[model samples]
Target chain A: MSDSDAQNLREVRAIIARHKLGDLIFLVTGLLVLMIAVLTFIALFSHMLIDGLPRLSWDFFTSFPSRRPGSAGILSAWVGTTLVMIVTAAAAVPLGVGAGIYLEEYAPKNILTEIIEINVTNLAGVPSIIYGLLALSLFVHQLGFGQSILSAGLALALLILPIVIVATREAIRAIPVTIREGAYALGATKWQTVSDHLLPYSAAGILTGIIIGLARAIGETAPIITIGALTFIAFLPPSPFKEEFPYISFEWLMAPFTVMPIQMFNWVSRPEEAFQVNAAAAGLVLVIMTLTMNALAIYLRYRMRKNLKW
Target chain B: MQFPVTARRSDNTPDSSTLGYNYRRHLSERFIEAMLFLTAFVSVAITLAIVVMLVTESLSFFKHVSLWEFLTDTQWTPLFDNAHYGILPLVSGTVVSSAVALLVAIPMGTITAIYLSEFAPFTVREMAKPFLELLGGVPTVVYGYFALLFVTPLLQKIFPELPGFSLLSAGLVMGIMIIPYVSSMAEDAMRAVPMHLREGSYAMGATRFQTAVRVVMPGAFSGIAAAYILGISRAVGETMVVAIAAGMQPNLTWNPMEPAATITAYIVQVSLGDLPHGSIGYQTIFAAGLTLLLITLVFNIIGHLLRKRFREVY
Candidate 1:
């Protein structure tokens, strides 16, 4: 080979090496970009834990809000959150599941079905605060639910209805067409097939969806705040038990309440450092609650995918 | 039922009673179907209720304040004695914060997507998935706290004159909070691009980076645009971060260093205070909400269309 040809070969190698360097630089940059998210997660969690760990105690769970920062606790808030969650689950599960079944199995492919599908997708994107406005007008005023636990529960029920419906539909869709055909060949009616086969098979997915929806609802502060949930409640809602012949009571649903997030918001807005500590503690609890639910959903999804054959 | 029975008898088959249809079961099935249909219709009812509520309340608001003034005025002090019902300040604040957030989220999110979709090994992808989910799962209020206590202090170290509650801190935290959302969606879009396209790029002697950026990105452009639109919607609608960290003072400015209120933060601030129903203060929130809904709806529709287009293409 000539010396000039050797020089051309060397230049070609140099150009290829330059491109490889660019690739290496981007790979590092991409990893660093992704690390921003991971690092933020660590920082936020540690920040809350450090600020809040000392505030966690048995008494902290048993007491109520107070004028004094050191004495205030989350008793009313947690109880309210629990009750609202119960109401939310009760209202959302049946409606969302039923809707999912209808859309997936019953509804004909027509204009109305298309409209409903589009509406559900768009509803998922509506801001949570707007739901608050809807509740404030419709439930608080027009329906006279006031700022009660039932109103807040119903509001969240509406907010998460789309999520549950989507999850349920996706789960139902995953079941093979052969299952439906087999059910039909067995002389089973549509409802019978759905009850025996479809609903049973999709139960895990539906539960995961419910847990996720409830988790999202639990941390939501804006809608509850917009519906006029009090920030400084010192007493819990009336319990759902009676000492009379009828042992179940419904009065608790109409009682005013404050949730965990709202309580944190109240404390965060306060002008004192002690209150900030309380807020951080409450935030830590809230984060744990949501993260645990999401983790459970992920685990359930993994197991479902692993266990199912078709 | 009659036709089937007569035909069977005419053909000299066995009595049809044994195979007769059960009308009771049929009726019950119809009832259940109707019930489920109603359940599905509830979502439509919700959409109607939202539009109606916002419209009626905003109608009352516009009754008192002209639409032109609400659109063009620079001030937005509805609670004070000298009330000016301009929405520009809130709009400007929302715009600036969302811009700041997108500036951080779009590039970071796109690069993260490229890395995850094109380059990450299996174990790396598995580990990173949960990290992203956890990041997305963290509550906005907690993010608000972080922005207020951690990020602001860190920023203040670099720029001493930065206020304790500036949009810059809140916007940055908001961007970090949004990273998981943007990256996951964009990654899904890029991964959906067929493997043959990447192979073609590789066959042409292109590097992995070149294939991902030049071939995969262009192939997935519509889907990525949809993801960016979603990130924008989330930023615009985000409340607690700006409410907690960015001061709720509605200032008409584009500078991220100065404190201002986004439409969401403004609504939260008003809700935190007591304003009687039917009062102007109350009505203002609805008007602001209507504006927010309109903005997000536009983005959502565009995103939905883009998603549909990309799904069809692939």
Candidate 2:
């Protein structure tokens, strides 16, 4: 063989060797990095649990915040969180589902519908804190709802509404057009077909989406903090029950509230060692709440994918 | 051939009764349709309301601080008596931290995506995805705590002179928080690349890694770019971690080790205090909010356009 041809063959072999080495390095590091990341996550959770368990007790979950770390509890925060979540779900769920139904089932192929679609998409990605500013201007001040659970819940509702709407629309869109056509051929009206076949089929997907949205909302601190949710809510909002006429009260709507995340934030900011432990415990609780919701969503999605024929 | 009419139902029920039932059903349908339309219009209304709220408040802010100085000034000391209205400090802080976040996130997240899509078995992919998402969904406040209490300390050990609250901690945690978003989106894009292309690469004597890196990555570049842009947008607007760990000082520095205030952090700082509505302090935060809004808006629009372009290819 000529010397140049010999050189070319050698270079090709060298290149292949280099590529094979590179491939091994790439595979090893790729798996290693993900492994480290996930292990760190587990470590972080364990750290929280270890640091927090000593501080956990019946009293820790029952009493209100106090000057002493030992006596301080998440009672007010959890109660306020539940109350706000109630209002948020009440407002957001129906509106989001209806909008999703309309966009998927009813919207015409026109610019208006496209605008609505883009609007929802943009809103879904807007910084949650900007929703806070919007809530501050529109609901709390302009509407004179004051700094109350009603305002906080309404703000969260708006924040999560886009998420819910997007999820619902995706679910509805997944149903075959032929399925709807069959319903139409059976003389079912548009609304009837939607309320019966479409809604039932998509319910698992839509519900899972809503739960995910709500989970995100539960973890939200920026918007709630922006709406000026009291960082140190001492007393719970007045009971919705009353002794007088009308029997039920809306007074709690205007009462100030704090949520689990905000309370944890406040504790984390404190310089005291005891408060940091308190923060860890509260963090653990919040993590539990969020993970449960996510697990539910994942399970629902898996079941829906498996059981559905199409 | 004409189809049999549903009007043949008049054989079972009176024609007038059938007509009445159809009319009632039509009215109900119209009512329900109108309600649904209004529901959908709520999103449109929300978009309008956000724009109006930001503009109206920002106008009041501009009245107090000239637009020229507001944009040009280097110092952002609005809370002090000698109020310098320059947004450079805040913008610089945002830039330094977000750049750090992207530097860490883009590589780790993309690598994770590649591993999951190209190498991992189905069970491994399924198991890893949920954990990644869980990591993503951990509240920012919790992350803020982790940064301030844990990450900053770890960095201080490494650097010995790192500040108690530095952009490094906040930026790193933000990177960790954003991994799921980047990886998941990019993975979906990479998976969408046609199988034939990879098979073709193999037929050409290319290694799987070579096919993935050279062919699949470039094919999915638009989606990856879009994912990265959205990830940057999120890191830019993130508030809690920066507020807690990135230091409260709005110093105009390029150093990630130094504490700085992002636009979101500044707004959070102002809001945490009881700033009265229409006051200059409140207006300033509104102005900051507007700036943050515009930045994210630019990124979102670009990402959307790129994704749209990608959709046209196949």
Candidate 3:
């Protein structure tokens, strides 16, 4: 072989060797870092779980909280979280989905529309605490909702609205324009086409989006904390309109409530080891709830994608 | 004569008649469309209203305390009788902790991204990405709890004077929490690089590592930078972790081993207790929040702009 050919071969081999070395280094380091992170995550949870699980029973789920750490259960917080999630979903879905449809199908392509799109994108990035502040000023103070679950849900609904709108728009946009054209050809009105055909087709995607949004809202603490979600509540909230309402005639709307994270925060911040265990148990419950919701959403999205004929 | 008879019959049929039925259908369609528009309008109005209200309240706050005092003052004793309005300590704490988090996150996150995109087997890459993302999905409060219970104790075992809650503990946890943010963004950028570049380097006898480090990384630098900045924004805005893990004292010191207060932590601390509205202490929370909002907003805008500016057409 020519000297040049031999030299080229040698260089190629050296390059390959160096490449292998680099890959090894990168892979080892990356895996190490990830292992560290995952281990920390497990350790953190384990510390809580190990100490708290024996204490956690059916009664813990059913019982009211107490100043005595051992007797306290997160029943009020659990109830509060459920009510907030329901109210937030109710308020967010219609408005978010409607706004999404309009943007995707009916809105004019103009600078104003562009501005609104940009604004929504930016809104998704705004800190959750800012929304809490907004809720405090507008809902709690001005609207006289005080520190009620209604105010907290409204704040959360607003926080997740941008995500819902974005996801809904994507779902709506995925429907073929040919479907709308086909409806038009059949002499069906635009509204009928959207309601009867398009909405149903996009239903699964919209549902997945709503679930994801709900998960995010449920995990959020800053906004609710900002809105003065009580850190401790011994009693479950009465129905929003019941006569035994705590404060204003809109007593349900004015009553204070604790959420899972806020409760966890309160417990974790306490100096006692026992409270730390309680925080872990609460964290475990919160994580399980969120993960289950997310898993359901993923399953629904898979089914939707699979069933989409077009 | 037959066609004329048929046309007359069609006109006589009310449902088949074009004018009245078509007009009514058009009106109803327009009404629903109008309703959809109204919903869109309301969302826009809500977002704008929030911004307007925050700014208006913050403006009232500014009137009472000069911007210089708010920005320059190092002591944050708003709740106490001796109220020092300086926001510097909180600002410095936020910056330092976020900086530390970025220090740990960027190299590791970028390398992981590189490995996933260029080096790792497809199965490995797929599994790693989602598993890393689980970190992001974990609530910040959990991270805070972990930092306090797990990380702080572990650190104390090694460094005896390490405060039970220190900035290092919080920063370390924050860094772990943001790994997914950085890795996912960086991976997207790396994936966006043209395959031809990698192939060409390989054909020229460059090894995979060389191609990735010299060609792919430089090609994806802008995107990686954007990811890093976004991670910083997330760390800065993060409240629960820092609030719970990094102690509440707004000390001006730069030591990572010491307990320090960040802006978000300060807000959390103050808001936990009942401070009536219009009090200087309560207003200070808004002031600190405003500062945090502006910092994050600027970072987000810059990151967005960079992504837009450098977006590869192909």
Best model per lDDT: 1
Q: DockQ for model 3?
A: 0.46
State residue A77's C-alpha deviation in candidate 2, in Å: 0.4
Better of 1 and 3 by TM-score: 1
Taking the tens digit of each residue's C-alpha lDDT, what string does model 3 give over A75-123?
9889899988877998899989998998898888898778778778778
The model with the greatest DockQ is 2
Q: Give the worst 10-residue stretch by lDDT in candidate 3 chain A.
A: A242-251
Task: State each model's C-alpha RMSD to the native.
Answer: 2.7, 2.8, 4.6
Query: Global lDDT for candidate 2?
Result: 0.89
Q: What ranges in model 2 sit over 4 Å off?
A: A1-14, A242-247, B1-14, B308-312
Ranking by DockQ: 2, 1, 3
Give the TM-score, chain B only, in order for the candidates: 0.92, 0.93, 0.89
Global lDDT of each candidate? 0.91, 0.89, 0.82
Docking class of 1: medium
- Of the two candidates 1 and 2, the one with more favorable TM-score, higher being better, is 1
Please give the range of 10 consecutive residues that has the lowest summed lDDT in model 2 chain A.
A36-45
TM-score of predicted structure 1: 0.96
Report the lDDT tens digits of candidate 1 across residue range A179-272. Answer: 8888877777788889999999999999989988999999888899889999999998888998996999989999999999999988988879
